[model samples]
Target: MLAIGLEGSANKLGVGIIQHPDRSSLEHNKSVTIISNIRHTFHAPPGEGFLPKDTAKHHRTWVALLVAQAMEEAGVTVDDIACICYTKGPGMGAPLTSVAIAARTLATLWGKELVGVNHCVGHIEMGRAITKADNPVVLYVSGGNTQVIAYASQRYRIFGEALDIAVGNCLDRFARTLNIPNDPAPGYNIEQMAKKGRHLVELPYTVKGMDCSFAGILSSIDLHAERLHKDGKRWTDPETQQPITREDLCFSLQETVYAMLVEITERAMAHVGSQQVLIVGGVGSNERLQEMMGHMARDRGGSVFATDERFCIDNGIMIAHAGLLAYKTGFTTKLSDSTVTQRFRTDEVFIKWRD
Candidate 1:
């Protein structure tokens, strides 16, 4: 069977086609294949973030072209698709609504069923499928979400999460403070800068038991940057008495925030008695974050599983993979029920396909 998925939960608008083999042809529990995955992001200028209205307009403008290109690349006609899948919630409301409307129109135009997928669940399922990490502790970190999740009693239980802004959001806003380019992505540019850093600046580290907070950390970093920019007071290492650069600040922020994420993920692993860890979402693609998670997982005699940018960042393929799982379990979203939301919790979706 085949599925066409649409994803526009944020700045990126994606269209993907996926194929699922029949039960007889499936092997080793691996049966899903990505036919094509195409995406275009709405890039905002430096020191600015993408607004929902503009992002929605971008999605509305490119969704059709993307879908057409995806289908052409996949060499599949609409008649070959079993369902049309789309992200339903936990994202910017305008972008989500725009994508949902496109999905509804496609479903009606092609006479196919519609599957509404949870944005977070799509990441988890895609991570599990690509890494083959069965029942691993999941750390989902993206622009809008930071969560430590695990499967228990047919639910992806949220063990820990951000109390305020997400880790990626913190990083993106910090990049804005430095007037870093948003092309490709703000986080990617920050990571590149952090690689060149040698000093680690002290910042607020707020972790309340399992959950972590980034709003205070972001504020502290922004204040420091402002002071450095306005006063021209050289930020120097207190011990080395050496000047600190913006790269150092980016490095320090990544280290501090990623450490909090690793700490909470470790706690969740201990709570669930699972050593295996699977990192998902856009922030999960950071090499530094992955290395830290690897260290933590190895300490527990386990391992870390993560995907490349193709699956890590927001894409339609994850939605197709996750939605197909739900569709096989007799799930469908009616036209009337295809509403979008900005706060869909991960645990709200019942994992009917998992044991």
Candidate 2:
């Protein structure tokens, strides 16, 4: 079956098309046919700090183009698609409404069922599908989230999460302190700086039980930056700085944050009695984090799985795949059931979404 997925929960506006084999799980699992997948994106305001109206407007303006691009890449027309999927909630209301409206309209036109998907579940499912990791602990970190999750009874359970600000939000704030570029993603610039920064400076590291707090860390960093500026010390370019480089800071930040995530993930694994680990979300794309998780998994006689950018970062294919699974299990939302949620807990969804 062909499915078209729309993802506009945050900064990106993506459309994806994927084909699922029409057969039982056993039959489909045994077959190795490469199902086609294609996607396209539109620029959303950087920093993931855009206003709801702006994000929604961007979505309304660009979704059709992205869908068409995905269709072209998939070598199929809109008529070939059998189902339509969209991210439902745990995101900004205006943006979610924009995408949902688009998907609902398309489904109406094509006579297809509109499926609502949890954005986080999409991240995990796509991570699993791409990496083929079975029962792996997931560390989902993004602009608005930082949580340790795992699959249980055919649903994802949140074992640990940030108590305050998200890790990505912390990184973005740090980038702003350094006056880093803000387009595309602030995390990217921070990553680049961390790559060139020297770890001559020590930053606070804090992790409590399975829950972490980034708000304190961000405040501490801000104070430190203020101190540095007051000292009349010249800050050099992260790319060209010598002696102690910005890359060192980048490395330090990546190391500290990723270590926290890895530590929490390990804790979750031990608590859940799961040996395998999987890293999801945009931060999962960081090579340093991947390496740390890999080593941690290996030390425990397990393996760590991470999805490529295709699934690692936010996109539509994952949403479509997750929505497909939900649809197959008779999980449907009535029109009256629609509601946008900014802080919907992953574990809470299991009660209503589990098969």
Clashes of each: 0, 13
Model 1 has an lDDT value of 0.92
In candidate 1, stretches whose alpha carbon ends up further than 4 angstroms from where it belongs are 23-29, 231-234, 237-240
TM-score of the candidate numbered 1? 0.97
Instruction: Return the TM-score for each candidate structure.
Output: 0.97, 0.88
Clashing pairs in 1: none
Candidate 1 lDDT, 211-327, residue by residue in tens? 999999999989778867975745766677878888888899999999999999999999889979999999999999999999999989999999999999999999998888888
The digit string of per-residue lDDT tens for model 2 on 1-355 reads 6778888887677787766665233222222222444444444344334677888898999888887777877788867776788888677788888988898888777777777788898888777777777667889998789999977775678888998888987887777776666675678777766766555455677888898888876776666566456654434435555433445555667777778888899999888888888888887887778888989888988888887676787888887777766665566655555445676677655523333
Cα displacement (Å) at residue 214, model 2: 0.3
